[model samples]
Target: MPRGEKSAYTDKQKRQAEHIEESEREQGRSKEDAERIAWATVNKQDGGGKKSGSGRAKPH
Candidate 1:
């Protein structure tokens, strides 16, 4: 995918990024910077959408 393209991310990842971005913005980051940081964080945590299937199973 092209740079800045988020199509490879899962819905949950996208939501996580959105939350991160919002928090960054609240901390005074610019919109672009916040989004960049958020996506970067998600990538760091989840490894950039490479694996198939949901990651570690949650307990019931």
Candidate 2:
């Protein structure tokens, strides 16, 4: 995948990013900054897209 392509992200991840971006905007961050921060936050939490096996392991 190309850089900045979100095709590997799950629906939930996308939703979370969108929400984070909106929150950052509400807090006065610039549009570009908000988007960057949102994706960064998501990556920090989820460790990038779901195609990676590292962050997908969870206890049931």
Tens digits of lDDT, candidate 2, 1-60: 899999989999999999999999999999999999999999989778876566766545
Off by over 4 Å in 2: 52-60
Model 1, 1-60: lDDT tens digits are 788788888899999999999999999999999999999999989878746656866345
RMSD of 2: 3.8
Q: Which pairs of residues have clashing backbones in candidate 2?
A: none
Listed in order, each prediction's TM-score against the native is 0.80, 0.83
> What are the RMSDs of all candidates, in order?
4.6, 3.8
Single out the weakest 10-residue window by summed lDDT for candidate 2. Answer: 51-60
Highest-TM-score candidate: 2
Clashes of 2: 0
Among all candidates shown, the one with the greatest lDDT: 2
Candidate 2 residue 39 C-alpha distance from true site, Å: 0.4
